[model samples]
Target: MDFFEVINNRKTTNGPFDPRPISKEHQRILMESASRAPSHFNSQPWRFILIEDAKKRAAIADLAGRSMEKLIADGLFFERYRPYFRFSEKELEERGDGIHFDQLPGPLKPFAKQIMSPTGVEIMRRMGVPKMLGRDNRDLVAGSPLIMGVMLDKAEYIPGKLSGFYSIFGMGAAMENIWLTTHALGMGIQFISTPMEIPENWQQMIALLGVPDNLELMAVYRLGYVKEAQRRPSIDWSSRHRKRLSQYVFRDSCDTPESDDL
Candidate 1:
């Protein structure tokens, strides 16, 4: 498919992937395509770790289950509360982390709940992932037919602040590459970040991937041949166009022409 077409058609696949194995040549091609993704300062901070071992996949799934349990125990399963159940501003204030749950408009409540829920963890367990970390190991000690790992070099800034935020952007670029390459090769890929359940252990997860001390886990993707391609729901472009360009664009002065383009 053409590059632009691939971009337009690409969609996240959640159903079971084809159980067939992907070839090394194809894997290499996909990785190369992913590496072409743009990065800030050409830092090229992304790294990949692929998991193919059944046993290891199970272990990863177990970890995910435990993570979900932890979140549920902590009363962090926000998905349980829909718009039908509302919390007062005082209650939201007490649960503060700058997360103003009560302040979210009614229509956006479902989205807010998904963001704060342990959905990722639950999904991982449901998928039956095994290894906590590793790529394509047929044996306990050595190689496998296919599996890869992706990592990101950590920035020296605090999370969500300044340079640190760019790390995610760079990682996202690489991720896009991975998806495109895999799809073009007629293979499937799944990116898992739920294992990094405890944000505090983010560094530890990076270490497990054998990345440099300063690096962090960006994603863990699984690859395999897919028997059939999954279908994506059609998007409602009309809703996206609800707002006019003027709502977001601004001129130096209101008196100035919006622009010939406008």
Candidate 2:
């Protein structure tokens, strides 16, 4: 695939992926691509664990599901991310950022406006939405063929330090390389992120991965080959919209915004 095309087409796969295991060649390419990312003074602080074991994947999935349920049941998920939920086309166009809920199920349509409110959360709970969504999340992760854990060296990833910021920047670049490579290789990847939202769940993941003292687990991702026909989850949103250049970019001076037409 073309370089720019690969970038343009790259997206977080929200649905389940094909069950086939990733080919060895493609895995090697992903790791090598990540390694090629530039680091601060060549301090390669990033580490990765490629998990293909079914049992381990199941365990991770369980934690992920339970975390999702807890977050939703306690109304933390909606409360914390309320700003990023757009319920209308006009809202999405005006913001030009954040996920747009353009594919909600019929039952959720009437409550779209108040979905982030406490009352809306209570309604969802009464409807058993948390368990339903939790099951969907679990199935998605459990069916994935590969689970990758990203880590950083503790020496370089210290909090409130210059090296810490640099390490995170380098890790982002490395993950971007891997993410784009997955798109070019006919595979899909999404972050297993809910577990990180809960402290206990995050610690469990670290233990399950057997992370060493020297390394800190930064993120987890599930990956597999994509299917032609993707079945959307019970509830879904799309983040295809992006901020225009004029909205986010600046010229030489901060006061001058770049022209989007250019």
Candidate 3:
């Protein structure tokens, strides 16, 4: 694929992926691309564990589902991420960022605008939305053909230290490489992030992955081949819109916003 095309097309797959397992050659390419990412003084701090075992995937999925259910049941998910919910096309166009909840199920369409409000939380609870979402999340993770765990070397990832920041920066670059490679390879990937939202659940993930003391598990993601006919989830969001250049960039000085037209 063209480089720009791949970059533009790269996205978090919010729906189910094709049921086929990813090829070993493609997996090698993904890891090699990650290895090529630049690191601070070549202190390659990132580590990855590729998981394809059915039992392990099911275990991780259970953690993710339980976390999502708990987060929604307590209304913490909305409280924590309210700022990033865009309800309408106009709001999305104005912000040019954040996920747009444009693909809600039929019953949810009426209360869509209130999704960030306490009243909406109550309504969703009454409607069993939390449980529904949890099931969806569980099935998505369990169905994925591959799950990857990303870790950082503890010696280089100390918080409040220069090496810490550099390690994280390098890790992001490495993951971005992997993300782009997935797009180029006709595969889709999504962060299995709900498990990390709850502290106990995160700990469970670390234990389940058998993460060693020398490394800190940072994130988990599911990957698989993508089919054009794949179905969307019960509820979904689109993050295709991006901020205009002027919204994010500054010119030569901080006082001047970069013109989007330029």
Which predicted model would earn the best TM-score? Answer: 2
Give one digit per residue, the lDDT tens place, for model 2 in 75-137: 999898888888788998988998876565579779887877899989889988888878889
In TM-score terms, candidate 2 sits at 0.97
Rank candidates by TM-score, best first: 2, 3, 1
CA RMSD, predictions in order: 10.3, 1.1, 1.2
Q: Residue by residue across 1-262, what tens digits does model 3's lDDT show?
A: 8999999999888898888999999999999999999999999999999999999999999999888888888889989988888878899899999877767667878888786688988988988989988998999999999999999999999989999999999999999999999999999999998989888889999999999999999999999998897576665554789999999999999899999999
Each candidate's TM vs. the true structure? 0.57, 0.97, 0.96
Instruction: Tell me the tens digit of each residue's lDDT in model 1 across 1-262.
Output: 8998776666444334555566668877877877788776876767666666666655554444454445444434344433333244554334332223333334444554443446643543343322221222112112122446676666532387755777677777777887877677666555444456567544444544556666565556556655564432111101111223454456897655454367
Deviation in Å, model 1, residue 73 alpha carbon: 5.7
Query: To one decimal, what is the Cα RMSD in angstroms of model 3 from the true structure?
Result: 1.2
Model 2: number of backbone collisions: 0
Which residue pairs of candidate 2 clash?
A: none
What's the lDDT for candidate 2? 0.91
